[model samples]
Target: MNATATAAPKAKANATAPARGRPVLGRFPLPLRVLGYALVVGVGLVYLLPFALQLVTGFKTDPDAAAHPLGLVPTTPTTAAYQRLFGLSQAGDGVPFLRWLGNSTLVAVLVTAGRVLFDSMAGYALARLRFRGRSLLFGFVVGVMAVPGVALLIPKFLVLNSFGLFDTYTGMILPLMVDAAGIFIMKQFFESIPREVEEAARVDGAGVIRTFWSVVLPMARPALITLTILSFQGSWNEFTHFLVATQSGQYETLTTGLARFVSGGLGGGTQYPLKLAAALLATLPVAALFFCFQRYFVQGANSGAVKE
Candidate 1:
């Protein structure tokens, strides 16, 4: 009887014990932890290797790059590629680097601004407004997102040609100004905000436009930043759309200019140094933006996780 009583108390104690958590890396056996670290390092190196090679190749001479394709050290470093890009040398090359840069900058800026304004307006309306066919409109937006961009290339070309917008900045920027995905992103984010906030704004005699512009937009900084980054990156790197929309060399952006240069359009033979240098310069702006606004990007990603 004493043994049975003692066993019962022990069982109750076991039942009341807190559950053990999963084992952390530090708690693992030393060899397993070492293996995990090695795996992570290997993956990191794999990603960094290409960038390292690109940086080194950009400084290499054309012959050196061809001779040592995989080498991370330039045999003879030269600034000739950069010099050509900036028009300090080879003035007759006809690459029009400055013009390409200007075009890209103009289009990217306009597209980003337009997406931010128009996408946010549409998103807010869909999220907060009581309008006819609201569900149907949202469904259409979602459907547009599902359509592959490549499939619309022919149709976009036709539309531009019909409107006489072909080979113009308007054609390039207008087609990209408001992306369906951006609208969806803004809509989802706006919906996550408290409805009571809008009610209070209304109670204070604020109209729809005033409430959206003055009250809610300020609180949507994370989502707005996310959309801005996406818009900038997408429009900056856009190649296929520009290809279909514009035919003139005068309208060529960085992507088209780079493509032509690489394909011997300006009379150079496998100029890896020049190509890599241009690519590196093109990548810098996006990289800088990402690093600067990484925190807001993370917050935007996590915004949809919680309801209120």
Candidate 2:
């Protein structure tokens, strides 16, 4: 009886014991861990190495950069490209780069603000507030999104010109102010949130606007940030619409100005440094915002992509 009892406890103890002799092997195999890390590092290097080269190449003298396109270390780093960009260096027929930058900033900021406000308002109405024609309006917005943006170029231009908004900041910004996709995104995000929260605000005798502004909006920071970032980036990088909308060099954004600069001739000689530098400058703001709020985007703001 004693022997049997002792054996039972020993077996129970054995069952609870850890399965590995090597301490780290309990977590993962060493080679597999090493291979996984190697794979991640390799992929990271592949993507980052190009930007690393481009950053260095931007500083290089034109002839030196051309000769050593792949070199990360520039033999002679000059600020000529940047200077030309800012019209500091005497590159003949100097670009109004500052004007272009300012125009781009103005248009992007207005468009982003308008989209955020208009989209969130529209989304809130569609998600919770029931009124006449709500479904029809939502359906129309979806249909609009389905329409290819290219097809509307001529149509949109006619409308803008008819309104005499053509070549003006208003024209550039007005058409982009309320995006259907952004409205849809906001609606989907709002709908996914539990009704209980909104109900509490209602029970507290808060008005619709009051609740949405104070309680609901605060809860929607993640979605708001995502929408804001997208709006800003979209407006900043906007090209085709601006191309058709504006006629004057005075109104040119970076995209428009750079397009003319890079593709002035049909048999296009690549001014890689100039083109790339402009692109880099244009990309920095969006890149900075993304790196800062990338965590929210990890949820994949698409409607079906997130599973509550």
Candidate 3:
């Protein structure tokens, strides 16, 4: 009987060994794996080519950029474009690059703060509080997420105009203070927290406000960081809304100002180097931010995917 039992286990192992060694759907042969890696690398290069070109072009002179638009190596590498962007060059006299940068920074900061605060509060309320029409309100939020933003442009413009918020910082920041996606993300994450935690807080003499503020909110760092990064990036990159919201050049953020700069509002010629330099600078902040908090961003994204 002992020998029979040992033979039976050996037979099972031998059966499974063949299956393990054989190639499955994703487990290709060595040659195919190498080919797959090469394919992925090729695709990555295709996506990165444009950014590489943009960086190289920013250092090229106008004539160089015009002559060699696709060149990865600059004929005469120069800091002229960057100098112009920073107002260090006399040729950059008319460009209010500093003003655009300031406006973008201010708006992005305010909008991010507002969204983090308001979105979290709204999400927590929807997730925890037992209130009338809760389902309806959540459904409405989901509906808002489905609605295309472009479709609301006209209505947003009319509302801003009606409320005398047009051409003002308040109009730019207020409209974007609460985003449906942020609210949804926060609510989902909040719901994943165990109810017993909140009950424990209450037993410790914490009221609803105290519990939410000190107990629950602190545990939601990942979601808050995610929301902050998204809000900042969105507001920083926003152009169409700013274009419709404000007519004055004083209100121009980096995106709107860059659009004008590229369209000959600020420069006479193509000014490809200058334009690319400005764009590169504008992109740096968001890129840096994402790189810095990427781990938190990913964690927050997956936080609500499962509930225990």
Candidate 4:
């Protein structure tokens, strides 16, 4: 009886021992953990300080902004910058902020939609379709991704001029509609989906297009959402392409317009408040998109990381 009681207590202790040991395996000392947390917080503040300054500077007068560029609070807060951006100022010839916003929204939407469709289709073909030279075509796609975007600017400019697409909405959006990185991302994700799922669709008398559209595309929601977010963000913030693609003020996007406006386009003496206000507004849409779809984005990014 004594031996049995001792064995039971030993087993219970053994069981509880691992649970206790688990905590100590990768645990840091209390002081070290506190230091690590402090370090992380300090780094976070470093990254966020500039944005805070920009936000506060937008409310300051030009003289105030110049005087206290790094201040978090304005000595004299004003809404003149916001008023000017929205054309609420008495000046009838305010900056064409609405036109820039509209152009960015329209182009971002169109480019995002086109990328979602064409990139997915291209990725699907590369992943699932069997054909001659398929490997070579996919290799070409991957190679294109390695090519520097800046290198293509002059070529893109020449092509747009030749095709009469320069200075048009089509010119601004067409070149950005399909991206190699987007195609690569979609291909990697599509390859991770089960072939049996596609086989069942085919067994149900579905053609290639029907199967891809109805069955596969629905299951690719995470990747599609990720692609949509990236495409919209890229096109919205795109400047170099828009710079060379169009020559007219009518084709100006938020990025291009803001660049010109901040760089003395309006012939100003350091309009810091107006410049910072416009940049802050331009950053909001992309920030909102990523936060909303953050979960799906993480899942999509890790889609092909492990195999079943």
Which number leads on TM-score?
Answer: 4
Question: Across residues 1-308, which tens digit of lDDT does each residue of candidate 2 receive?
Answer: 99999999999878767654445533678788788778889999999997887788778776787788898898987877788788887746456778889999999999999999999999999999999999999999999999999999999899999999998888999999999999988888888788899899999999999999998888777788888899999999999999989999899998898888878531245556666677788778889989998887655365324635
In model 1, the Cα lDDT at residue 170 comes to 95
Name the best candidate (by lDDT). Answer: 3
Q: Model 3, range 1-308, lDDT digits (tens) per residue?
A: 99998999999999999788875535777898888889889999999998999899999999999999999999989988888777788754646788999999999999999999999999999999999999999999999999998999999999999999999999999999999999999999999999999999999999999999999999999999999999999999998899889999999999999998888887488899989888988999999999999999999888967666
lDDT of each: 0.90, 0.84, 0.92, 0.91
Q: Candidates ranked by lDDT, best first?
A: 3, 4, 1, 2
TM for every model, in the order presented, reads 0.90, 0.86, 0.89, 0.91
Instruction: Report the C-alpha displacement of residue 272, candidate 2, in angstroms.
Output: 2.6
Check candidate 4 and list the clashing pairs. Answer: none
The better candidate by TM-score, 1 or 4, is 4
User: TM-score of model 1 relative to the true fold?
Assistant: 0.90
Scored by lDDT, model 3 comes in at 0.92
Instruction: Tally clashing residue pairs in candidate 2.
Output: 0
- Between the candidate structures 1 and 4, which one is better when assessed by lDDT? 4
Off by over 4 Å in 1: 1-24, 90-94
Q: After superposition, how far is residue 42 of candidate 3 from its true place, in Å?
A: 1.8
Off by over 4 Å in 3: 1-27, 92-94
